[model samples]
Target: MDQKLPTIKEIAKRLNISVSTVSRALHNHPRIGLRTKMQVQKLAEELHYEPNTLAISFKQKKWFTIGVILPELNEQFFSQAISGIEDVATAQNYTVLIGQSHDSMERERMLVEAFRKHRVDGIVLSMAKNTDDYQHLEVLDKYNIPLVYFDRIPKGGQALSVSSNIRSGAEQAVRYLLEKGHKRIALLKGPDSLIASAQRQEGYTSALKQHGLQLDPDLIKEIDLSPEGTRAALTQLLALPQRPTAILCFNDYVCFDAIQAARQAKIRINKDISFVSFANLPICNFLDVPPLASVEQHPYRQGQLAAEMLLDIVEKRKTITDIKPVILDTELRIF
Candidate 1:
């Protein structure tokens, strides 16, 4: 049978002192006499006593734990971002509770609810790709839990967020292809629900307009970022009457899928058609035929900044009354 653990009540009863006195002595409160403090410490050691962290946290109403929700943990970009968050959290003596939404709105909502019930001090989230609804996010506000979003933020800049300048990154990618003498450029974008997808589309259209090329509606396609969805989009683009000589993808993962599909269709990568993408993940370097270039979104930096912002709000070091979005500039990384 397991032994019953000692508590402050047991210590106070044995010492013939009040439970409050024992508690204060254990904490080394100034009101506690030196003799009483020593006695409490000695008894605690003798009894193998351990402080009740849950009780202390309840009394203080500060758990020193933060929750992080991401679309997918397996993605290289999100994995690197989580590393940054963990580094910051560990240094500050804070615990991070992680959850993967898997791009499902329902899963994201459930994770948010669970985090709230856990009484986490704050939350850092990368909204799921299909999460167009904001009720789950707004509930955090109702509970007075500060929130900071990274990467896949909501449509508006009304809330605190850390993200890359995706529009500029897309424009740079399209311009790079244009400079390479590829007039017909196609885009394999993410779901329309994602703000990042809209930004990429805007950039693609702007770049074409700048070069006096009309936007080809048929050349742009939206995919669910699934292997099958990406393959279907790639096939449709390839079947166009004037197929695109160059393609811009949502991210490195999408590029990987599209490139594989093209190769299966007997298309030579970088020779028959070049490809560019965002989220310049490290895995791209090891691929047999990697993207021609990628846009470096700096996922790690975004994670660090977002965590810092959320911690600041939680620790009362900064006010959350005003929204301050941190937008990092992206660079085109050539293979």
Candidate 2:
């Protein structure tokens, strides 16, 4: 049989006091004497009394819980970002509910709906790779729920977001490869749906133009970020009449796939085709031959900033109109 749980009424009955008195004493109300407070607390502990969070949430009009959604948890960059988010939530005495969209737009929409139905205080999100619609996110406005996006944010500055400067990072990456005497450099970019991909392309184009070189659309290829997509893109780049001496990949994971595909084709990494990438992930250290360089996007810091911003809005520390988008400058880290 299941054990009966003790309630404030039971504690009051045992102590021969009113339920209101027991409630006030348990809360250590100033009106209650210290002796009475201690007595109630002692008996409550003996009975293994646990306050009903559901009741407390109703009374406070807040759940004290926040939802976090990401594209992939297994990725090192996202895993580190989650750690940063949890740290901030813990300090604020908030519970975190996590979900993975798996880069699916439908999954992302469903998670948002579920979180909204659960009445979470706010949400932090890194949009899925294919998420082009914002109707699901805009629905949060009806419920007055705050949202803060990080890393893979939507394409506008109107939304509260924390992201890295991918355009500058991409420009720096290409410039570094150019200084190394690589004129024929290829770019393995992400799907065009991602704003980051567009930014990277802009940076790549800007760098080439500055060096008196014309932008060659033939040297650029787009990938869906899947290993298969990356390998296929690599194959196309290698088949070009003038093979690229170096490649700048979307990020470290894409670079890893590209490197593997090159090795399989009997192409020597770094010698035949060097590589640079974004997201200076720690996993790069474990690889026998990582990218020649990586752009630091500061995923963990972006997560922290996103969480803090969402909490601020939820707690009424700041209004939506008072907040501005946060964009961190990127750094290129040489291997």
Highest TM-score against the true fold, candidate: 2
Model 2 residue-pair collision total: 0
227-265, model 2: which lDDT tens digit per residue? 999999999998999999999999999999999999999
- Can you tell me which runs of candidate 2 are displaced by over 4 Å? 1-3, 12-33
For 1-335, candidate 1 gives per-residue lDDT tens digits of 99999999999999999999998998899999999999999999999999998888889889989999999999999999999999888889799999999999999999999999999999999998899899889988889999899999999777899999999999999999999999999999899999999999999999999999988899899999999999999899888888989999999999999999999999999999999999999998888889999999999998899889988888788898754899999999999
Report residue 44 deviation for candidate 1 (angstroms): 6.2
Query: Pairing residues by index, what is the TM-score of model 2?
Result: 0.93
C-alpha RMSD by candidate, in order: 2.8, 2.0
How many angstroms is residue 77 displaced in model 1 relative to the true structure, after the best TM-score fit? 0.9
- Enumerate residue pairs that collide in model 2: none
